[model samples]
Target chain A: MHPAISVIFFTVTSGAGFGLMTMIGLGFPMHNGIVAAFLSYLLGGGLAVAGLLSSTFHLGHPERAWRALSQWRSSWLSREGVIAIITLLLFAVYALIWMFTGQRIAPLGWAVAAGSLLTVYATSMIYAQLKTVPNWHSKLTPFCYLAFSIASGLLLAGMIGKATLILGLPTPTIIVIALGIAWIIKSVWWRRADTIGFSQTGSNTGTATGLGHLGKVRLLEKPHSGENYLTHEMVHQIGRKHALKLRAIAYILGGIIPVIMCTFALFITPVFFLLIAAISMIIGLFAERWLFFAEAKHAVSLYY
Target chain B: MTLLPAQTNKKLGLVIDLDVCVGCHACVVNCKEWNTGGYGAPLGDVDAYGDNPSGAWLNRIHTFEVTPDDAPAQIVHFPKSCLHCEDAPCVTVCPTGASYKRSEDGIVLVDESMCIGCSLCAWACPYGAREMDPVENVMKKCTLCVDRIYNDNIPEIDRTPACVRTCPANARHFGDFADPNSNVSTMTRERGGYDLMPEMGTKPVNQYLPPRKKSRPEETTEIAPAFVPKAGEGLLGWLDRALEKLG
Candidate 1:
C-alpha cells in the first residue's frame, strides 16, 4: 500500500483504456463515423501499452518480465500478464479487420472484449487473492475492478460520442448507471474494512512471537535502526485524518461528481462538459486506486 | 510447478527457545555471513558505517519488554526468519515459478534466475519472511542453510542451519520434524512448542518454545549467592583505580 506512482498510474490508465477497448470490441455505434473507432482503439491501446511500460519502472529486472507469464496456472499476476498480451493482440487484429473489411465480426469482437475484461479481472485478483491484505481479500475487490473499468470505459466512449456528436443520451445514461454501480461497490468495501479482519488480531505481535499467553505484547524495539525492505514496502501506512479526507475525495471525484456531470451531459450536448467529466473521473479514479493501496494494511505489520 | 506436493517426506525446520535467547544477534549475523558466501544471494548492505544503515537480512532479532500482571517486567528476544510453511503462499504466488517449497526436505527456496521481482510473493507472505535485495533486484530469504545441512564435506555436528550453529545461548535447534526421535522433535514435544499464527493455516514447520515459568520468590530464598566476596573486597581501589594510577 505504498501508493507507488508508477503502479497507481498503471492501474488507473490501463483500467480505463481496457474499458474503452472493451467498448470498442462490443462495436459501439458511432454517428460521427470512424473517428470514434479510431480514437477509442488508438487511445485505449496507447493508454494500456503506456501503463504497462510504466509498471516496469519499479521492477528490479524489467527484462525478465516475460518470465512472469509462465506461472499463470498458479499466479494471478502471471495470468494477468498473459491475458493482457492476448487482449492487446486481439484488439490489434480486431482493429485491423475493422479498418480493412469495413465490417464488424461479432464473434471476434466479443472475444476481444471478453479478453480485455478478463485481463482487468486478473489484475484485480492479483490483489484480491491476498489474504494478508484484508481490505482487498473480499469478493468486493473484483466487483469494484469490473465496475470501475466499465464505468471509465463507458464514460470515455460517451465523451468521444458527445464530442463528435456521434451518439445521444443513451451513452451518458449508461455512464451514469455504471458510475452508480461503482459507487455502491466502493461504499460497501470501505464500510466493511473494519469487519473483514483488517485489525490483524489473528496475527498480532503477541501471536506472531508466540507470546500471547503472557499478556498484551507491544513493540519495545524494532529489529533495526533504519528502514529495511519489509518496513519500507510492507509497512506503508496512512494517517487516519488523511485517510478520511482521501475517502471523501474518492467518493466525490470518482463517483458522485461524475454521476452529476454525466447526468448534465445527457441534457447538454456541449463537448467540453462530457470531455471534462471524463477527465475528472479519470483523476478521481486515480485517487480511488491510491486509496485502495494506501488503506490496505498488510498482515506483516502486525509484528511491527 | 508452483503447486505444493501433496506431502513432504521430511519437515526439516528450526525450533527456537524464546525463554533462553539472549538476543545477541549471533544467529542473524552468522546467517548472513554463511548464506552470503554460500548458496544464498549476497546479503546486501546499504549505507554501512554511515548515519543510517539498512540492508537485506534473511533473519532479524526483535526485543520486547513484557510485564504480566503478576510477574516482574522481563525482556524477551524474538528471532524471526522464514518458517517454511506447508502452505507457503509466497511460493504459490510467485508468477515465474521462482519461489518453491522443496518436497524432499520441506524447505522453501527461490530461483533468482526465474524471479521477475514483481514482489507479489512478499505481499502474499504473512510472516514477512522474504526481503528484496536492492542490489540483486530479486527476493532473498532464509534457506535454512540448505547447502550446509546437506553437504557431505561438512562435519556431522555442523550439519545444521548457520543460525542454529552460531547461537551462543544454544537456543536454536534444527532437525527433521518428521522424525519422532529427533532432538528438535523431542524438545518441541516436551516444551509445548507451538506455531506462529496458526490461524493463518500456514502450518509452519518451525516451532517456538514458550518461556518457562520461573519459581516463586519464596522457593529460591535459601539458594547460595552466585558470588561471595572475600575479605577486604569493599576497598575503594578497584581495577579501574589501578589503571588510572598507571595513566
Candidate 2:
C-alpha cells in the first residue's frame, strides 16, 4: 500500500477522462461542427491517453506493457488494459465520425457510454479483486470508482459545454446531485476503510502467522537490517492527524466546493465558476486517491 | 496460462519446523545464493554497501516472540518463501501469462521474459513472497529451487532446494505433499502443521510446524555461586562493580 504517485495520478486522471468520455457519449452538451467536437474529444481522449501512459511509467518494463493484455481471461489488470484500449479505440472512431459528419450517432454514442463505464469498472476491479488488501476487496470499491467517474465526468462535460457554447451548460442541479452522490459514496468508503483494519473480518498478525493459539505474538527480530521490496512497496504509514486534514481537504475541494460553485454558477459568471469547480474537483480527487493507497493495509504487512 | 490447472500432480513445497530453527537465516542466505545464478533473474541488490541497501530476496526469516497462555515465552523463527498455493492468487493476478503454477509439480514460477513488471501479482500475494527485481525489473521468487531439485548435474543427496540442503538444524524439509506416505505429509499429519493466513483462502501447499511447548524440570536445583568472595575483596574495577550491582 505505498501511495505511488504514478498510480494515484493514473487513477484520478483516467477516472475523470472516462467520466468525460461517458458524458460525451451520452449526447450531453450537444457538440456540433468540427471545432467543438474536436475540442471535446481531444480533452477526453488526451486525458485518457495521458492517464493510461502515466500508469505505465511505474512499470519496471514499460515496453513490455502490451503483453499485459494477454491474460484477461483471469487477470483483472489484463482485463482493464484490454477493455481500456478497446474503449479508447471505439471512442476515437466515434469522435472522428462526429467531428467530420457533425452527426451524433445514437447507437455509437450508447456503445461508447457503456464501454467507458465498463473501462472504469475494470480499473476498479484491478484494486477490488485484491483480497490481500482487505480495504479494497469489497463491492464498495467499484461503487466508489463508478460514482466518482460519473461525478467528475458530469462536471467536465459541463465545462466543455460552456467553453464551446455549442449548447447551454448541463443543469447545474444535476451536477450538484452527481457531486452529492459521489460524496456519499466517498464518505462510506472512507468510513469502511478506516474501520477495516480493526475489524474482526480483516487479517491480523496472529491470524497471518497462525499463532493466535499462542496468545500474543510480537516481532522479536526482522529478517534483515536493510530494506527490501516488500518493506518499500507495502509498508507505508501516514499520520492520523495528517490523514484527517487531507480527508477534509479532499471532501471540501473535491465535493463540497464544487457543489457550492455549481449552486452559484447561475448567479455569477457561470463559465468561470464551472471551470473552477472542475479544476478543484480533480485536485481534490487527487488527494483522495493518494489517501486511498496510503491508508490501505496489505495482508502481507502482517508478516513484516 | 493464468488459469490454474484443475489439479497438480504433486504439491512440492517446504515444511519448516519452528521448534528446531535457530533463526540462523542460513536457509535464507543459501536460497538467495543459489537462486541468484539459477533462476530466471539474478536476485539483485541496490546500494548494497551504501547508506540505504534494498534488494530482492526469495526467502526471509522473521523471529517472533510467542507467549502461550500458562506457558513460558518462546521465540519462533519463521522462514517464509512461496507457499506454492493450490489456489495461487499471484498466478491468476498476473496480467501477462508470466506467473503460473506448474500442473506437473505445482511449483509457481514467473516467466521472466513475459513479465511486464506491473507488480499486481505481488499485491495479490498475502505472504509477500514475490519481489520486483530492481535490476531485471521482473518478478523474482523462490522457485523452490526448481533447477537444483530436478537437475542431474547435482548429487542425488543434494537434489533439493538450496535452503533445505543448507539448513544446519535440518529444520527445513522438501518433498511432495500429495503422497500420503511422503515425509512432508507424514510430518504435517503428526506435527499439527498449519498454513499461514488460512483466512486468505489461498490453500497454501506449504505448512509450518508450531513451536512445541517447553518442558521444565520436576525439581529445581540450587547451585553454589561460581565464585566465593575472598576475605579482602572489598574493591574492584568499575566493570566488576557494574557486574556486582547487576547481580
Candidate 3:
C-alpha cells in the first residue's frame, strides 16, 4: 500500500474542506448576530468547492467521477461521491434559506451539517472496511478521519474569524483546543498501528500457492518478463527508513506544531496563531497522508 | 432485453485444500485455458516458445518448504487467487464504477466496458488477483466462471467452474458461502480453515485448510567406519615422513 501523494492530498484537503463547510452550516445562526450571513455562506461554500476541485486532480478520469454515484448499493466510494453531492445541494439550499429569511433554518442547517459528517464517514469507511490492509482495518480510521476533519475545520474557521474580525479571540481559542484533541487521537492511532505485526502467509508470493510454510519465499521466477499490470501497480514502493522519517516529519508539522500555535493563540491574538496553525496543518497532514500510503504494506507487494 | 439483474444469489468462491494440493499447477493451466477462450479477451502470451513465456492467469500455484524450529521440513503447495472478499478494497478504490461487489452474493467483479484501466483496483487489492487484459485494455479476474456456472444448457453436474471441474483430485469446491450449511462452509469449519493474510482484514471468503502434519520418519542409527587404516598405510606413512622432511 504505497500511499500516493495524490490520494493523501485528496483525503486531507477534502476532509478539512467538508469539515469547515459543516461548521459554517451548523454555526449559521451565530453568523447573523456576529457578521454578514451572506458573506459566511459564500466563503464556506467557496472553500468546500475549491477543496473538492483539488481532490478531483487525483482521479485518473475526473469526468467519470459522476458515474461513481451509481453504485451506492455496494461501493462506499460511490456512496462518498453521492453523499458529497447531496451535501453540496443541502448546503446550497441552506444558504438560500439563510439569505431570504435572514436567519438559520433549523432543520435545513442541521440536515446539511449531518450530511457533511456523513460524507466524512463515507470517506473514512472507504479505507476502514478493507480487511487486507491491517493498518486501516480498525475503529480508529473513521474516528481519525472525523477528528482530522474537525481539526482542519477549526483551523480554517479560526483563520476566517481572524480575517473577518468577528467573534473576537475566544472563537480561535476554542478551535485550538479542538485541534489539540484531534492530534492526541491521531498519535494514539499511530502507536497502536506500530505494534501490530503483519501475517506472513498473506504475501502474494507465499499465498499464491496457499502454503502456510514459514520458510523463506523469494521470487524464484516471475510469471511475466515485462511489467504486467499487477507488477506495475502493486510492486511500486519506497524504502522503509525513508517512510519512518517522513512519518516523524508529518507528526511534528501536521500534528504538534499546529497544536502548539493554536494553544498560544488561546491567550494571545487570534491572527498570528490561526495563520500558523492553518499552514502547519496543511503541510503536516500532507506528510501524514503520504505516510499513510507509503507505510501501508499491500498484500500484493509480496510478489516482488 | 437481457436483464442481468443488479443482484443475484450466487456466492461464487474457491475452496482450496492445503493438504492435497501438490503444487502441480494443473489448476493454473486449466484456469488460463477456460478463461482465455471463453471471456472478454485472450490471456496473451508475449513469447510462447521463445525466451520468455508470460501471460495473465486467474490462478497461480506456489510451492514452499515449511520447517518448524525444532522439526523436519515439508513441502507445501499453495494455490493463490482472488478470495472475493466481503469488504473488497478493489471495489472501493475504483474511481470509475467499473469494479463492484455483488450485494446478492459476495462476488467482487469488474465490468470490462466500464473499466478505463486506471489500475487503481490492482493497487487496492492485497491479493494479486486482478490483471489487465492486454487485448481488451480492461481489468480482468477470475469470475468463478459466472457464465459457465449458471448456464442451464450445461448439465447440472458440469455447471461447476472450469477449474473445479478439471481438478482430478477434487481439491477445489465451489458453492454459496452465504449458506451456513453449504458444503464449502461445513468443510471449512470442520477442517479449521484459515484465510490468507487474516491481518489484512479484507475478510476474504475463500479459506485454506492448513496442511495436516504427518508422523516423523524412523531414525537410522549411525554406523562405525568399515575399515581402520593399520598404522597408516605403509606407503602413505613413508610418504608422510618424506613430506614432513621436505617441509
Off by more than 4 A, model 1:
A31-36, A162-169, A194-201, A238-241, B218-247
Q: What is the DockQ of each candidate?
A: 0.58, 0.63, 0.18
| iRMSD, per candidate, in listed order | 1.3, 1.1, 5.4
Q: State the C-alpha lDDT per candidate.
A: 0.83, 0.87, 0.70
What are the per-residue Cα lDDT tens digits for candidate 2 across A1-304?
8887888899888988999999888888555889999898988888888899999999999999999999999988898888889889888899989989988787888888888899899999999998888789889999999999999988888776743323344466788888999889889988888778725345688987788788789888889997788987887775233788899999999988999898887577776888999999999998899888888888878887
Clashes within 3 Å, all models in order: 0, 0, 16
Top candidate on TM-score is 2
- Check candidate 2 and list the clashing pairs: none
Candidate 2 off by > 4 Å: A162-170, A198-202, A238-241, B217-247
How do all models score by TM-score? Answer: 0.91, 0.92, 0.71
If ranked by lDDT, best first, what sequence of candidates would result?
2, 1, 3
Clashes of 1: 0
Please tell me which predicted candidate would have the highest DockQ against the true structure: 2
Interface DockQ of candidate 1: 0.58
Clashing pairs in 1: none
